[model samples]
Target chain A: MTRAFNFSAGPATLPESVLRQAQAEMLEWNGAGASIVEMSHRGPEFMAVAAQAEADLRTLMSIPDDYAVMFLAGGATTQQALLALNFAAPGQTCDYVVNGHWGKTAIKQVGHYVNPHVAASSEAGGFHDIPARSSWQLSPDAAFVHITANETIHGVEFRDTPDVGNVPLFADFSSSIASEPIDVSRYGLIYAGAQKNLGPVGVSVVIVRRDLLERAGQPRADIFNYRSHVARDSMLNTPPTWNWYLAGLMFQWMLAQGGVQEFARRNATKAALVYDAIDTSSGFYRNEVVPAVRSRMNIPFFLPDDTLTARFVSESKAAGLLALKGHKAVGGIRASLYNAMPVEGAQALVAFMRDFQQRNG
Target chain B: MTRAFNFSAGPATLPESVLRQAQAEMLEWNGAGASIVEMSHRGPEFMAVAAQAEADLRTLMSIPDDYAVMFLAGGATTQQALLALNFAAPGQTCDYVVNGHWGKTAIKQVGHYVNPHVAASSEAGGFHDIPARSSWQLSPDAAFVHITANETIHGVEFRDTPDVGNVPLFADFSSSIASEPIDVSRYGLIYAGAQKNLGPVGVSVVIVRRDLLERAGQPRADIFNYRSHVARDSMLNTPPTWNWYLAGLMFQWMLAQGGVQEFARRNATKAALVYDAIDTSSGFYRNEVVPAVRSRMNIPFFLPDDTLTARFVSESKAAGLLALKGHKAVGGIRASLYNAMPVEGAQALVAFMRDFQQRNG
Candidate 1:
C-alpha cells in the first residue's frame, strides 16, 4: 500500500514501524488471546504496557523524581480547564503569556474559574514572535504563569523558557514535545495531547510537580482533580487503552532512534531545508513569521495568490504529499514537520516547491 | 491464532471481524493515502468518516431527530461529572438511584458539583436486586433523576424504564446500551462508554434531548459546555478520531447482523444457558442476584469457597476462557457476554462449567 507524507497539524503522522506492529498484534497481543484494545486496563497485560510507557517516557524526558506523570483522556484543552480547577482558588488571578491561538484558548477555557491576567501577548504583532519577557506584567499572587510552548496555527514557538521568579510555569507542549530536549524541571507542569509528536489521539500526557497536587485549588468533581488521577496512576477511570498503547509504542520508537538529541539535530536540518526553499523563491513564496521564533514543528507559508495556493494543495496531494492546507483562521499553506515526518519528506516538499516556483514565477 | 472466549468486563471482547478490518486498514485507509488515525479531524476525509459513523449509529439505535448525539473522548465517569456541571446549577439537588459499584462511583464523581441525594439504594442488600421504583424517594425539585440502567459488577439490570414523573430521567447505559431497543423519548439523556456493547475503550456516546442544551447550569470552560460541543458537532476540540472510527465500524457490523432486536434474542438465549447452569448446580455454584433483574450481559457468580474460586479461575483460563476473575470489590468470577461475544462462546463456557463442577464438587 502507498502511504503519503502527511503534514496535518495534530493527529498528525505516525511511525510506519509502530503501525505495522499494531497491525500484527491487532487480534491477539503477545499470546494474551485478545487485542491490546480489547483487554482490561487493570489486567496484568495492559498494566505492564502502561507502566513501561511511563518509565520509558521518564527516561527519555529526564523527568525529575519530584514530578508525577499521567496519561489521561481527551486533548490538551481539557487540561487547560483542569489547570484552573486543580491549581487556583476560585477567581484567583493567573498570569497568561499569550503567544497565539492556543495561548488565547488556554485563557478562554478557565475564564469563569480564574481571573486570567494577560501578562504579555504577541497578538498585536499578529503572533509573528514571542513577546519580550521584560514587558510581561507579572502578578505577585498569581496561581501560575501559563505559556504555549508552540503555537500550531500561528507557527510560533518559545525559543527559551522565561524565568517567572517564584511562580510555577505551565506550558502546553502539544506540537513541539519530543522534537528536542528541554529541562523538565523548568516548568511546574508540562502537558501535551498525544496526537502530534506522540502516537495517537484521545490520550494526553501530563507531567506535574508532586507538590502542586496539594494546592486545594477549587471545588470540583473528582474526575477533574489531577491529584486523584495521579493517585490512581491515570486509571482514575477506564483510560483510552488503545490510544495509550499506541503512544507507548511511539515512546519505544523514539528511544530506539536515539532519543530527543538525535531528533533535535534532524529537526533543525528539516526545518532549515523548507525555510531555505522559501527564502530562495524570490517573492514566489513568503512566510510571515519572524525568523527568530518561527516554529520548527509547523511552518505556515503563503503563495503569491489564492489561485496558486489552491493549485499547490491539490498538486501536493497528487505528488504523494497530504494535508498541506493551512488553518481556516489563517488561509494559505502550512507544513508540519513533527517528529514522525521524515527528513526525506521535507526534502521532497522542498524539491517540489522549487519546481512549482520555476513554472509559475 | 487460537483466540479465546474473552469474558473481561468493560474494555471487553470485540467482534473478530471488526479487528480484522482495522488490521487490514492500519497502514492505509480506503485509499486515503494515510491511516485514519494519522489525519486531521477537520480534513474532509475524516469529516466523511465521522459523519457516516454518526448516521449508522442513529439508524442502529433508531435515535429520533429531537436527540443530539455526540461521540466524545473518555469513559462514562467523565460524563457523570459533566452531567452535573452542564445541566445543574451549583449545589442543585439531583436524585440518584444506586444499585452497585458503578452507581456509587457516579455519585462520587459529582459530589462537589451537585447535591446528590440517594433517592433509592440496593447497596444495603449487597446490590443483589434493583431497588423497587415504587419505593423511590425522588426529590421534588431535583435537576434530574439519575439511574444506572445496568450494574456491570453486581449483575443487576432494570427490566423497564421507571416513570419518574415530570423530572427528566438521566440514565448511565454504559454496559447495556444497544443490547435491546427502547423508546428514546423515555429519557432526557443517555450516555454510554463504548467499551462494552458499543466498540472500544476511549470513546463515549452521549444521546441527549435537544432542549437540555439551553440550560445555563453553572460557570464552566467553553470545552466543558455541551452547547459548544454540539455547535461544533463534537468537534469543539480534536476528538478521539481513531476510537470514533472503530465504533463506527462496530455500528456497520451490528447493522449487518440485523441490529439490536437480533442481539436481544441472542443475549436472552446466552444468559439462560449460563443461569440455568448455576441454578441446576445444587449449591456447587451460586448467583445471588434476583433472577428477574439479573443482567443478560454480565453474569457474576461465586464458587463454594475461596480455594474453589481461585481454582476455577485458573482452570478456566487453561481451558481457553479468559478474564473470569471477578472485580476486587466482590471477589468470585464474572463472565461478561457483550454483543461481540458469540453464542458459541457462551455454549462453550456452559459446557466448561458443567465439567468443572463435576470435578470439584
Candidate 2:
C-alpha cells in the first residue's frame, strides 16, 4: 500500500515502523502474556515499559540529573495552566513571550493562576517574526519566563533559548521537541504534548529542574500539583498506560535513527525542500514567516489566488497527501513536517506545489 | 487463539470484539485510507466517531438531554478534584459519602478545592459494607453530594444511588459504568476513567447536567473548566484521541450485546459463581464483604492462610486467570468482572478455586 503522508498539526504522523510493531503486538506484548494496554501500571510488565520510555527519553535529550521527568495528562493546553499554577505563588508575576496562536492562548490560560506579563509579543507584526531576544522585557521578580519554542499555526520557531538572568525559563516545546538536540540545563522546565514529533495523543512530557520543585505554588488542588506527581513518579494516579508504551517505542525508534541530531539534519533537509519550492514560486505562493525564524516542523504557504486554496487542498489530498488544510485561524495551506514525516513526503509536497503553480499561475 | 482472562483492576480487560476490530483497522478505517488515529478531531471523519460515541453512551445510560457528555483527560482521581473546583465556590461545603478506598481518597482530594463534608462513612466497619441510607447525614447547603458508585479496592458496591434531596449528586463510576443500566437523571454529574469496561487508559467520560454548568466556580484555568469543554464539544484541546476511538468501539460492542441489561445478567451470573465457591468452602476461603452489598464487579476473597496468597496468584496466572492479586490495601484475591469478562472465565475460576481448597484446606 502506498500510504498517504499525514501533515496534521497534531494527533499527527508517527513512524511507520512503530505503527507496524504496535499492530503486531496489539494483543500481546513481548510474550508478557497480555497486551501492554491490558497490564496494570503498578505491575512489573508495564512499569518496566514506563521506566524504559523515561530512560530512553532522558538519554535522547541528555536530561540532567537535576531534572524530574513526568508523563502527564492534558497536552500543552493544560500545561499552560498547570505550569503557572505549579510555579507561581499567589500574586507572583510570570513572564510570557507571546509569538503565535498557542503562545497567546498560554498567556490567557496562565492568567487564571497568576499575573501573566507579556514580556514580548509578535501580535503587532502578524506573528511573522519572533520578538528579538534583546527586546524581551523579563522582570527580575518573575517566577518563570514562559516561551513557546515552536508555533504550529503561524510557522514561527525560536532558534535559541532565551537567557533570563536569575529567573527560571519555562518552555512549551510541544511542536519542536526532539526535532533537534537540546541543552537540558538552559531551561528550568520543558514540556511537550506527545502528538506531533513524539508518538500519539493522551500523554504530555514535563521535565523540570529538581530545584524548581521547592518553589511550587501553595497548590489549590492536588491533581494540579506537579510536586505530587514527581513524588509518586507520575503514578499519583493511574496514567495513560498505552500512550506511555507507544511513547517508549517512539523513544526507541528515535534512538535507533541516531537520536535528535540525525532528526535535525533530516528535518533541515525536508524543510528546505518545501521552503525552496515556495520561495521560487515567483509570486505564485507566499510563506508569511520571516525566513530567519520559519519553523522546520510546520510550514504555512498562501496561494496568490484565494479561490485556488480549496482546489489545492482537495487535489493534494487526492494525491495521497493529507491534513494540508491550514488552521482556521490562519488560512491557506500548512504542511506539517513532523519527525515521522519522511524526506520523501516533503519532496512529494514540493512536486505537487510546483505542478499546481504551473497550471494556476 | 484463546485469550487469558485479565483481572487487573483497570487498564484491564476489553471485549474480544473491540480488540479484533481495532486490530483489523489499525491502518485504515471506513475506507478513508487512513487510520482513525490519523483523522483530525475537527474533521468530519473523527467528528462522526465522537458523535456516535456520545450518542451510544447516552442511549446506554438513558442520559437525559439536560446532561452534557464530555470526554476528558486525567482519571477519576482527577475528577474528584475537578468536581470540587468546578462546582464548589471557595469555602463552600461539599458532602462526600466515604464507604471505601476511592471514597476516602475523594474526600481527601476534594478538600484541596473546597470544604468537604463527610455525610456518611463506613471506616468504622473497615470498609466491609455500605453505610445504610438511613444513617447518612445530610447538609442542605452542600454544593454536591459525592459517592463512589463502586469501590474497586474494598469490593463493596452501592446497590442503588443515594438520594440527596435538592443537592445535586455526583458519582465516580469508573469501575461500574456500563456494567448495567443507570438512571442518569438521578445524578448531577458522572465521570469514569476509561481503563475498565470502556477500553484503555488516557481518556475519561464526564456527563454533567447542563443546569449545573451555570453554578461553576470562579475559573481556575480554561482547560480544567467543565464549561469550556462542554461549549467546545470537549475539543477544548487535543483530547486523548486513540482512547476515544477504542471507547467508541467498546460502546458499539456493548450496544450489539443487548446493552447494559445483558452485561448486568452476565456479571451477576459470574459474580455468583465466585461468591458461591467461597460461601460453600467451609471456611477455607472468605469474602468479608456483606452478602447484599458485595460488588458484582470486584469480588475479593481471602485464603485461610495469608502465606498462600502469592502461590494462589501464581497458580491463577498459570491457569490463565491474571491479575487476581488483591489490592495491597486489602490482602486477598480480587477478580474484576467487567463487561468484557466471559461467563466461562468465571466458571474456570470457580473450578480452580474448588480444587485449590480441596488440596490446601
Candidate 3:
C-alpha cells in the first residue's frame, strides 16, 4: 500500500503498525474464531481486550488510584454537557477557559445545562494566543474549571498544565492526549476522543477522580450518566467493540514505542520542523499562535497571499501529504502532527512548502 | 483460517466477504492512501462514504423521503432515553408495548424523562409471548407508541407491524432490521443498533419522520436533541465513523444478496431448521416462546436436563459452533441467526443437536 501522510484532525492518523496488525487479525483475532469486530463484548475474547486496553492506558498516563477510567461513546462534544450536568449542583457556575472554537462550543453546551462562567478567552485576538493563567478570573467556588488542552482549529496549547487551585480542572485532551505525560492526579477529569492520538472515532477515554463521580447529577438520562457506564465497566451498552479493540492495539503500539515520553519527543520534533519551515519562509507563511504556546498536535499557518492557499492544498495533495486544508473557522492550512505522523512526514511538508514558496514567489 | 459458526447474540458473525474486504482496505481504502477509519468525517472521501451508506440503507428499507436517517453514537441503550426525550412533550404520556428485556429497559428509561404508559406487556408470562394488540391499554393521546419488533433474549418477534393508528409507532428494530421487507412509512420512527443484522456496535441508525424532529424538547443538552443531529447530518459530533463504514459495507452486502426479501427467506429457513431440531427432540429440548411469534433471528430453547447446557455450549464450540449459551436472564441456549449467519450454520447446529440428544438422551 502506497500510504501518504494523513493529517486530518480527529478521525486522524493512527500508527501504521497498529493498522497492519488490525488487517492481519481482521478475520480472526489472536487465534479466536471470530474477528474483533464480530466478537461478543461479554465473551472472554473481547472482555480481556477491553480490560487490557484500560490497564495499558492507565499505565501510559500514570493515572492515580482514585481515578476511574472509562472507554465511552459520544465524543468530547457529549462530554462537554455531561461534565456540566454531572458536576454542577443546581444554580452553581461552570467555569470555562475559552481559547478556541472547541472551548466556545463546550461553553455553549454547558450553558444549556448551567450558566457557564467564561473565566478567560482569547477570542478577542482571533484566538491567536493562549490566555495567560494570571488573566483567568476564576470563581473561588466554581463547580469545575474546563479547558481544551490543545485547540485543533486555533493551533494553541497549554504550555504547562494550569494550576486551577481548588476548582476541579476538567480537560478536553482530545488533540494532545498521549502526546505528553499528563499529571492525572491534578485533574478531576480528562477526556480525549480516541481518533486523535489513540485510535478511531466514536470511542473516548474518560478518566475521572472516583470521588467526583458521586457529584454527578442523579436525574440525568441513564446512558448520559457516567455512573451507569462506570458501574458496568463501560459496557453499559454494546460499545464500539471494534474501536475498543483497535484502541487496545494502539495502547500496545505506544507501549512498544517506549511509551508516552518517546511519543512526546517525536511529536515535538514534527511540530518544530513544520514551525521552522513557516518561520524561515521570510513572511511568506505565518502561524499566529503565540510561539510559547504553539500546539504540538495541530499547527495552522497562512500564506501571505490568501489566494495561494487553495493551490497549496491541491499541490500538497498531489505531493501525497493529505488533509492540510485548514478548518473554515481558521482559514489557511493546518498540518496536524498527531503521534502517528512521523518527523519524516513533517520534513516532507516543509520541503513541499519551501518549493511552493520559491516557485510562487 | 478455520472459521467457526458464531451464535453470539450481538457483535456477532459477519459475512466473510465483508471481513475480507475490510482487511484488504484497512491500510488504504479505495486507493485513498489512508485507512477509512483514519479519514476525516468531513472530507469528500468519508462524506461520499456517508452519503452512499445512507442512500443504500434508504433503498434497502424503502425508507420514505420524509424520514431523516441519522447515524448516531451510543447504542440502543441511549436510544431508550433519546426516544422519549426527543418525541414526547413535557408531562405528556408515551406508551410502550413491552415484550422483553430491552423493551422493559426502554420503558424504565422513558419513565425518567416522561411518564411512560405500559400499553401492553407479556412480562406476566415470563416474556415467552408477545402481548396481544387486542388486550393493549394504550393511552389515546400518547406522544408515541413504542415496540421492540424483535426481543433478542426472549426470541419472540412481532409477526407483523402493529397498526398503532394515529399515534406514531416507534419500533426498536435492533435485532430484526433488514431481516424482512417492511413498510417504512407505517412507523413514525425506527432505530436499530448496527450489530445484529446490520454491522458492528457503537453506532445506531435512527429513522425519524421529518415532522417529528420539531417535537424535540427546547432545553435539551445539544447532543441529546435529535434536531441538533438532524441539522448537522448526524455530524453533531465526530460520530462513529468506523461503525458507519462497516454498516455501509453491511448495507452493500445486503443489497448484493437481493436485499431484505431474500434475507427474510433465508432467516425463516434458518429459524425453522433450528426449531425443527428442538420440536423433533421429543421432550428432550424445548422452546417456551409461543411458536406463532418465534423469532427468525434469536431462537432460545431449553434442554430437559438443564445441567447439559454447559456441555452443549462447550461441545458446540469444540465442534466449531460458538456462543450458543443463552442470556443469563433466561438460561438454556440461544442461537442468533442474524442475516450474516448462513442457513448452513443453523443446519449444522440442528445436526449437532440431534447427535448430542441421541448420545445423551
Q: Listing every candidate in turn, what is its Cα RMSD in Å to the true structure after a full C-alpha superposition?
A: 0.7, 1.1, 1.1
Question: What ranges in model 1 sit over 4 Å off?
Answer: none
- Per-residue lDDT of model 1, residues A251-280, tens digit only: 999999999999999889999999999998
What lDDT tens digits, residue by residue, belong to model 2 across residues A73-124? 8888888888888889876899989999988899878676788999999999
TM-score of 2: 0.99
* Candidate 2 lDDT over residue span B1-361, tens digit each: 4478888889898877788788877777777756777667888788889989999999888888999999988988888888888898987999888989899888777665788888899999999988888988878899999998999999999898887899999998999998998888899999899898787788999999999998858557878789989999989899888889899998999899899999999999999999999999998889998888999999998997777878899998998888999999988899998888889989999998988887788
After aligning candidate 3 to the native by TM-score, how far in Å is the CA of A76 from where it should be?
Answer: 0.9
Tens digits of per-residue lDDT, candidate 3, B284-341, equal 8999989899999999998876778888988999999988999999999999999999
Grade the docking of candidate 1: high
Docking class of 3: medium
- Model 3 misplaced stretches (Cα beyond 4 Å): A216-218
Q: Against the unseen true structure, what C-alpha lDDT does each candidate score?
A: 0.93, 0.88, 0.89
Candidate 3 residue B351 Cα shift, in angstroms, is 0.5
Each model's chain A TM-score: 0.99, 0.98, 0.98
Model 1: pairs clashing at backbone N, Cα or C within 3 Å = none
